[model samples]
Target: MPWTLPSRPSRRSLLAGAAGVAGAALLTGCSDDRPAGGESGIPLERRMREAAVRDSARLLERYDATAADHPALAARLAPLRAAVAAHSAALALPPAGSRSPSASPTGGTGAAAPSAGGEPVPPKPAEALTALADAERSLSEARTIDLAGAPGELARMLASVAACGAVHAYLLTSTPGATS
Candidate 1:
């Protein structure tokens, strides 16, 4: 008897594979010598990557502050905080000639957010959530504006992260179990 052919892969699997391939390419293929902007001899892409890391760190700080101040909400914010941590890891620029991504220069689990240091968290849980949502929205908008000038792979990554940030903003404020 003739053997049956293998079933076709689902659309979800295909897209996931494509994304993995694309991410690998970007990680291993970012080679450029041109300097778009450098006040202290840093390339624009490097600056952008650093900025992304810094912003994510700040967001993580906000998440941590909210969780610490409002232990009751910690469980709810944990997943979102983990996502931001992963974003922080992914946004880091690898050392020269390295292909894989690394964590930020701080090397602190969640302790080195420069700009977020000393910022007071709102006393009310709702207000704190609103602050987090505002931060996410602001960062998302900034990333969207930055997309026009970013090169190929960086632009794709930035767009994706920006979209994630927008989604985070919506999630932070939108009521749970609300009817349509």
Candidate 2:
């Protein structure tokens, strides 16, 4: 007797087999052995938000110190300082029922005033602006890295913040009166 080739599978049979495999995978994937809660169950997002708040506050303090040391640059630096304040406020807001973790107190108004014990003051307006621009650039770069692991909503927010930081750096460096 001659051996005959096996017949091709019908489309319906192929589809049924695929569905059965998928169903089995779905059931197994839902097993209770998976870890619960967010990254390591400690909420990495919350920690990221808190760090953003603290960094923003520190940037604001630095701006204040720079402004106080070079009163001539106060008018020019005001808008940048205001932007940092806004970022700080946004980051400081905790999720429902959660309080913002305490960051270093930004001192009081004029708390960062240039004095013997205060933050070191840059000798020139250009130097201060350069420092601020550098800082903004650094934060923008960090946010780019952070976006990878953040949830959808938080990733969007981080992207926006990163864009804002880049804009701030550009403005600081390209302003008409800014020194080369």
Estimate every model's Cα lDDT from 0 to 1. Answer: 0.76, 0.68
lDDT of 2 by residue, 1-180 (tens): 999755998898899998997555444433332233644655665566766766666667777778878898888889878877776666655544445465333322424333334347668788878887887898888876666555445565777888999998998878676587
Provide the clashing-pair count of each candidate structure.
0, 0
Specify the highest-TM-score model's number.
1
Q: Alpha carbon lDDT of residue 172, candidate 2?
A: 81
Clashes counted in candidate 2 amount to: 0
* RMSD (Å) of each candidate, 1 decimal: 10.0, 12.5
**Candidate 1, residues 1-180: lDDT per residue as tens digits?**
999855998898999998997676555445563565446776667677778887888788888889999998898889988988787777675544654454444434546545625468899999998898999899898987766566567777788888998998998898877877
Per-model TM values vs. the true structure: 0.71, 0.62
Candidate 2 residue 14 Cα shift, in angstroms, is 38
Which 10 consecutive residues of model 1 have the lowest summed lDDT?
99-108
| TM-score of model number 2 | 0.62
